[model samples]
Target: MPSLGADMEDGTLTDWMVAVGDSVSRGDIVAVVETQKGAIEIECFEAGPVTDLIAREGDVVPVGAPLAVIGEADASDPNRTEIQAPPADPTPEPVTSRPQDPPVPSVPEAHEPTPIGTADASMSDAAPQQIRQSAEEPKASPAARMRARDLGIDLTGISGTGPGGVIVIADVEHALEDVTPARPLRHQKDAMRQAIAAAMVRSKQTIPHFYLSHTMDAQPAIDHVTRLNADRPPSERILPGAVFLRATALAARDCPDLNGHDNGEGFVRADAVNVGLAIALRGGGLVAPAVMEAAELSLAETMAAMRDLVARARTSRLRSREMTAGTITLSSLGENGADAMAGVIFAPQVAMVGLGAPHKRPWVVDGTVQPRTVVTMTLSVDHRANDGRKASQFIAAFETHLNRPDAL
Candidate 1:
């Protein structure tokens, strides 16, 4: 179990997509773990054959716990473990008189306390259970078994259609339709809240932050997006959010102070602008997954990426790498939202940029006062890494990008 976030110390293994002896490659999703953020598919970082499975589905264990061990690929090992047929018997033996040894069970070996969920298939006592299961006990995960037990549903007759002919949680959920509609659980929300609180407290204690706010003319960017989307389909239409993100990434070229992290030694600038967008989850929490290499993408590409990121974040389907790789964060209040927003800095990354809803405001243009569309942009930076002068340059560069919306 990998630590999905700073506050997540443990997670529950919900499902295993691969089985013992299965070949796995790098980036293959091996299992799904239920953390405070909900079910996240865990990817394998190595390429090998699965030799041992130490954690079973629905087992809650601390971070860094071994879920499975992938063994080096070797043809000889399979041959060595292969069973051979018994030599021909000289005389016919009576089946009733011959005694048979039970199949050896493969129990999970753990350094920590055993999780109270389903035991691995290898860990099961095969003999007695095999005899009893002749009535066709489906190969179901521990969580599915627990659900069946709780729901008073029989698994013997239901045909399993999961990987390797196993029964999964979805099978149990399908059974749930006959009884009651399954709503999202509440405990996950509470856990997410606690995790957010812990992270915020840590950030506030360690990072010395300073704030800067500027009111930018929003009409130019708004008109640019409006005209660009005028002919495009609804799905491909651009939004003001994309313009803000693009401008931030482009502005970092002139003022790189906002695009880096502090590793206690000193400030280290990132090679690329990976902007993290603060997205709110419907369940009640916030996650800022990155738009990797945001500076390299086009305005339309950024909008598409933002849409996908927000969708995945809300669905609790984000990947491990996406969760940990943000350089700087961007938070925005939508239309009808607050006039301005000042946000806390997510640590390691020294800065956070926020945008408020655009509204008509009085502005003097060429010594004449007139109503203009404007938006407040606020930046939060770490005092240890950069000074106010650099921050001002960044904001100026950002405003210039917004003004030249056609170039964005």
Candidate 2:
């Protein structure tokens, strides 16, 4: 396995998209390797036939171990990326069933004991870690030891998941998660959790964040989505989230400054706006996968992209590209109806708008009071980039757009 990066020492072979005997062209994905972050597609650097696959799916081999042999011994075929697969069990053949002839004579055990220290030293060198552990020394990893210490559980009693019985944190977590109801379901949070944690920490600490909230009537958007989905099939129903994406994109377009990045001296703007929709995963956490050039997509187009994005996000198939490069973001707590929430602005991006829960409240319209559905939007801006007036104007234009949703 070639070293993917500095942080990665090993990778799990998630899947082999191309199998042995399949012709692999340049840029064709041969396998998917799952690092700590997520699964990344491994493409062939050279065009040739796939011959040998030393590592099967789920193998965690060391880096630069030549996981699969490439280039034939003869260098015969121009298309040969690797040599043919060798026969299985190529090691020196060992006797399968021993001969049934008379066995060798057995030696008698000596009753006399050698020097105790010398014999114990020999045993320590000969036997594995299990034989060496005592009341003084623990044969577990730091994680295992820490967990054992914290929980008042002995590592010696728990089975290890690490290599060569080196107790690991997972073995402890598994044992705890199964038996203890107190321990949270940490398994649900994986790579994305770490990514989010790092991002939130960086954003909160490094970036100066400020929030501007606006509560507007939701009837326009509701009517718009209903009308859009009226003639179309059920599968093509336009969700409010789609409208939110379109509105955010349009707002970005109106306020070019918000859609751009700070280049030290002046602002550098992006040509097309991409909006990230923050979606909550099943158990916990959230993923914000962006849809590129959302400003240009029609209602139907935005709906389709929204459907696909949500699908990919839930499946953990969202790539790094899908998660980045958003000029702005629109996070919806739809029906999640949080009255209004302050959302963290993803760094490097200028702004993020959070869509709050839609609820009915009494409102006065030209001296007449009526109940209406209202949804609040909180805009989180990077203070260093744009002032409050620019933010207010963008929200005004966005509200106008939402009011005239039929034109969308």
Candidate 3:
């Protein structure tokens, strides 16, 4: 058994394609293993006569555990092969079946003559050739081997389609398409998706949410960042997100009610200030990795932490400590230039704030029109925990935090 994911240790053998007395070639699909994520096909790592099958089907094997042995069944008997290997090796050296490196390679066909002599023990006994490990082994193709390597599927468990039992890439594709008694492919991906689904459902259905929107000037803050990063090293530039996180933390401290939730029985106040920053992955899917004790960190520190968190989250390497338990949430759809994005509250979190892209618009300035960086912020608050007035105050305070960010 081989490891599939960072958290996965052992995998259950889903099924076996090859049995004792079955002949297999290198890169052949042999077995299917069920890992946390899905059912993955296995390919043979070596081309040899499988003299013995150690582990049977449905066994949970750890990574690097011995699964079987490959070698000549018997030196004296030319016909001898692993139960998984063919009855006889037409090719004198089994290794010939395997192609050399793609750059320069040799491919040898089965050595048996067009008219292979009858399988007669009388002739073999007369001139006995000492059986070597290579003569009796089954071999698979290189491409098949690579697939199994990444998927962590054992080749002995799979059957092959190529002539002489050679495993091919198509074989792996077809195997993944077929469904079995165990979980189908993408089980782990579906599992993670379900977890996210549950979180969304809990937040939407159970929580009573209220909406609040406001537009604040960003000129001051933009200049503030410019001044801070002016003489600083490129690596030490102040980030806009850090300013937002720091300001949100400060606003939450002032309007504790917005920071807390109404847990039906009463208003529940969270002792810690964990803020979940929503991150959008490249392909799709969104994850909110949290920044703990946001109130305690300075603007620069918060910026550094948020940057690191987003990087790790994109790589799917975020630790458990980086997930959930935020008092308030921030969703940034600014890159998409969405006028506004209404956030779905994650359960227990009183409210979520979404930021829209800032665009220059001409507004009436005294009787004349003037340009300004117009932006929108939407706050989705749980109605169970807060009312319109409370939501309004929270939004007001949030706008103030941005309006006079220096004070914040």
Per-candidate Cα RMSD to the true structure, in Å, reads 15.8, 15.4, 22.1
Give each model's whole-structure lDDT: 0.69, 0.61, 0.58
Candidates in order, TM-scores: namely: 0.70, 0.61, 0.54
TM-score of model 2 vs. true structure = 0.61
Q: Residue 126 of candidate 3: its Cα lDDT?
A: 14
Per-residue lDDT for 1-408 in model 3, tens only? 433321223456767767666667766766666643345556664566666666778886643455555566664666543222221111111122221112101123322211222222111111122111133434444434434443555556466766566655445544654533456434446544534553564355456666888877666676788788999997788777677777778777777877754433455777767787988766556777678788888878888888888887666555323443467888876534777778897555678888887767775656887786666888898776678887788777777877776764
Q: For candidate 1, lDDT tens digit of each residue in 265-300? A: 567787888888999887478888889889999998
In the range 1-408, model 2's lDDT, one tens digit per residue, is 433321223456778787666776655656676754456555555565566787888886543333454445344666544321111111111011011211111111011122222211111111132222344443454324434455556665677654555555456556666666652345436434644654565456544788899999878788778777789888978888788778888888989988954432344677878887888888767777679889899977998999988887777676434444566778887785679888997655768898888888897767898887788889998887888999898889789888877766
Task: Judging by TM-score, tell me the better candidate of 2 and 3.
Answer: 2
Positional deviation of residue 126's Cα in model 2 after best superposition, in angstroms: 47
| Superposition-based RMSD of candidate 3 using all C-alpha atoms, in angstroms | 22.1
The ten-residue window of minimal lDDT in model 2 covers: 89-98
Clashes of each: 2, 1, 32
Off by over 4 Å in 3: 1-189, 261-266, 364-368
- After superposing candidate 2, which stretches have Cα over 4 Å from the reference? 1-13, 16-191, 261-267
- Candidate 2, residue 283: Cα displacement in angstroms equals 1.2
